[model samples]
Target: MRVAGLVLAAGGGRRYGRPKALVRHGGSLLVERASRTLIDGGCDPVVVVLGAAADPVRAVADLRGCLVVDNADWVTGMGSSLRVGLGALLATDSVAAVVLLVDMPGVTAEAVRRVAAGAGPAVLAAAGYPPGRRGHPVLLGRDHWAGVRATARGDTGAAAYLRAHRARLRIVTCGDVADDRDLDVPADQRGGRRG
Candidate 1:
């Protein structure tokens, strides 16, 4: 199956005081680390959606050689960035997209593979972590692109779509909560690296 990976790095990082995508984790920038996982998983022609700190992010990500999409409407919200990235991925290829978040530092190549492995026309990688808390980075087939674009409810994100099409959703259980953790605040960004 043809699969394209889209990394969402359009967040402004208002809570973190700096671009979270540019933050270092284990000697590599967050975006670079995230993109590499996708690439390593055999997801070719990856694209990164940049917004708040596009320039800085681009500098670090340039070496990875992935396409960088600037999401000017990022201030609008995460939903807008997701749409832009998905639209870009769809516009260039016919492959299904495995959307990855920049702040999710612990998301590994194996996890990405697990998510994409079970991808379908309208399935969401409802990642269950620790005690049943669910997380995102859902896989979407090209068929659901339009629905994702039309989504505009609350901050509920892709949950709305998955909920509406419950029968189509697939749960990819993961033991690592880090795959589910979103590093939006300063504390989250640091805690992952500590003892």
Candidate 2:
């Protein structure tokens, strides 16, 4: 549906001691895998937001041709990065945007596709994972862009936007997968499967 794919990879990853987006998962870096999922799910004009380790992360992922936005104010918080990323998308031709987190390596292509396909002016595609936990690659329509950009502050994310507009949210279920499985800590980067 001509949606924009935003990869939120600007975090410092202080808990993991390095950039989590470039962390190896299966055979590819997490950011690359996430981008591939978005591209496969029908998103065009994808953009990746970089911060903490922007240079090495970009080099490791080989994102030479892809659009990249630097979130120099990343230290401010996730919301700052979100605003930066969204601002970049504003210059593009995307009618809808599915914002993905670089740490979520488990977010399947099907999950992304389902969300992107259901985007609308007010309806947001919320991730329905186990225990009813909603998470990112949340699809935000162009209508919500202004409000989203205005309200983002500190660590607060689009969740505030969803809460303020609960009636407009369209929950898209994606089985038992924990699309919210973010690899912030070392244990989380280990696939959350202990032997």
Candidate 3:
């Protein structure tokens, strides 16, 4: 199946005091790192949703080979970004999508590839951290796009939808090979060697 990459980079970074997409890590912007991780993990035609400081992110982030999408309703929350990204992926010939967050600089391509390798048009997969915690780089099959979009609201993203379909969800244990830390606050930004 053809699985595309969907990077949600529209957050305003209200908590972080700056657009997280533009945040630098390992000599590259966070958005660039996220997109590159997806591409390296085997996703084709990566689609990135941009909103907060879209112009500046475009200017700094090397978005070459990516399908950049503008989410006008990004201020509303992550749900809008998710909807916009999934919609863009739906327009393609992709059978599923590997969803990554721009703020999660710790998630590596290995994690993305592990989840994406098991994704299909009707499959649902997510990266699992230690102690059975679920995190980003979610694999949403095309079959669940409409339902996920319908339930996606506020900053919840696809949490509700994924919970509703928990019986069929697959959890890929990635904690052993990847970190799922998110750069949400200033303290997270202070860490060394991100990404």
Of the candidates shown, which would achieve the greatest lDDT relative to the real structure?
3
**Model 3: ten consecutive residues of lowest lDDT:** 186-195
Q: Give Cα distance to truth, residue 32, candidate 2, Å.
A: 1.2
lDDT of 3 by residue, 99-192 (tens): 9999888889999999998678999999998787898789999999999999999999999999999999999989988887888887886774
lDDT of 2 by residue, 88-192 (tens): 988887888888888887788788888888576665777786567677668999889889988888878787888999788888887554356777777865666
On TM-score, the candidate that comes out on top is 3
Clashes of 2: 0
Per-prediction TM-score: 0.87, 0.91, 0.96
Give the winner by lDDT: 1 or 2: 2
**Arrange candidates by TM-score, highest first: which order?**
3, 2, 1
Per-prediction CA RMSD (Å): 2.8, 2.3, 2.0
> lDDT of each model, Cα atoms only?
0.73, 0.80, 0.91
Candidate 1 residue lDDT tens string, 73-165 = 787877888788777877665457887888786777777777788565545565567666656556877788788778833245466776777
**Judged by lDDT relative to the true structure, which candidate is superior, 2 or 3?**
3
Give the lDDT of residue 48 in candidate 2: 86
Q: Which ten residues in a row have the lowest lDDT in candidate 2?
A: 186-195
Pairs of colliding residues, candidate 1? none
Write out the backbone clash pairs for model 2.
none
C-alpha positional error of residue 135 in candidate 2 after TM-score superposition, expressed in Å: 1.6
